[model samples]
Target: MARLQSSGFFDLGDGRLEYHFVGRQPAAAPTLVLLHEGLGSAMQWGALPETLARTTGCGVLAVSRQGYGASSPVSLPRPADYLEHEARAVLPRILDAAEVGSGVLIGHSDGASIAALALAEGEARLRGGVLIAPHFFVEEVTLSAIRRTRAAYERGLLRTRLGRWHADVEGAFRGWNDAWLDPGRRGWTIEAALTRLTVPVTLIQGTEDAYGTRAQIVAARRSCPPGLLTVRELPNVGHEPHREAFADTVAIIAAFVRRVLEDEGAGEPHRPDGAPMGE
Candidate 1:
């Protein structure tokens, strides 16, 4: 199995971003780029990076965007179009900095929305995407959940927990929470972005997710080209399916990753146990 190649902060000129790279990308295989949730960082990804590298024989790069993890904090009251900005402006720079020749993005929550937007706008190196609990548009459930989270943060419960991972926990929380709760953002939607996807995409969502409902899934199905999209809804699971159902999530992702690589003529992916993955 490939070992951790490096872990440190990458200077983006304006600010440094934290990153953890596992394994080296083989000439034939695409790198798996992990985009964390709103409040997540490289460290928050836990064992997913290493496990993905070992299972798929591919490199994995997990990055923490500005205002999260050990990265430099951003000014509060982020713009409503921040997700679009990240997708079009920030993500390309990150991909360039990482020197990712070819990649598959695996994103969760806010990161998933960014990934979808990036794919829609077009990124040359990106072959496909695995989006977990992505929000295509604003919903009452999403606003209500953020309000409850805001209450928890105000009560110091959420802050204390998130403090363990972020150096500026307040910035991380407020940046995400404030943006979502912005009344102007009530009309926020990436459904138009979904319609522009040229590459294949796999969307994974949990039926029990409090932040979003099946309507999000319905939006994707309605917008994206039917042949290019795949959907998986897990029963009895929540927003963080990777953490809530690790093995199952990994299996599903690995299968899709292999299919993507195979379509690129990169060859089959093997299980950590050394057996070839079934189609």
Candidate 2:
């Protein structure tokens, strides 16, 4: 039998956000919540969500955040702590509305950063996380790459390509592009919050990722420790490892989720707010 696919919008109080489920109806297992890159969306994930669900026996829920895809358009120029706010407040609301009580987060680029922040702040429903090319702190390479992206958007290719995935293409581009380029956002870093993360984390980065460096992997490893952290570096790949290395990425994600479920089943405690218990 063919699996089902469906899409919908959630009224997140602040605004509406678009989301889709590619595999099971109610989203299964500790649902694999997939978060998109800055300019990417649920559709932009291509077949990965469905593939992940099949590979891991979990439901894959992908959301288009605030200003991307079929979601509401932004007013331009998001705040520096935009990701933090989403992680701390908005994510829980979305999850509650969707009726997903627990999940394993798989985040890419900006979405990855949001995953890290959410975990760090002790989001209790999160069993673990798979962060791909996540940035804890601002880096020159990231800013530079984003600047180039803005130039490309201005030149047309970036926007035109983004249009296929986003309903408000300009809002998607400028919201992410403008925030990172803002000088005030340069001081942004979740390094301190990282130490508070108790659940396991898997960090996947490409050696050739222009937006970030191995420094992110190194830092996450240092803070999260050996048992709690897993690092995977794909050689000769760029920003989007999941898109660029689909087969390998799915394999890693499936294995990581299995490990997390095993560990949790053994009775690792969590707080009332859903954050993992202890550091």
Q: How many residue pairs clash in all the candidates, one count each?
A: 0, 3
Query: Model 2, 19: alpha-carbon shift in Å?
Result: 0.7
lDDT of 2 by residue, 1-279 (tens): 223347888887778988888544443345778888888887788889877766665668998888989998877678778998889988888778776766889999989989988888777788999999999899999999999988999999877888888888878888888888998988888888788888999999999999999999878877774588889999998898888998888889988887787678834323223444343
Query: What stretches of model 2 exceed 4 Å from their correct place?
Result: 1-5, 25-28, 266-279
The candidate maximizing TM-score is 1
Each model's TM-score? 0.94, 0.90
- Looking at model 2, residue 178 earns an lDDT score of 85
TM-score of decoy 1 = 0.94
Judged by whole-model lDDT over C-alpha atoms, candidate 1 comes out at 0.88
Q: List the residue pairs that clash in candidate 2.
A: 123-274, 124-274, 124-275
lDDT for each of the candidates?
A: 0.88, 0.81
Stretches of candidate 1 off by over 4 Å are 1-4, 26-28, 270-279
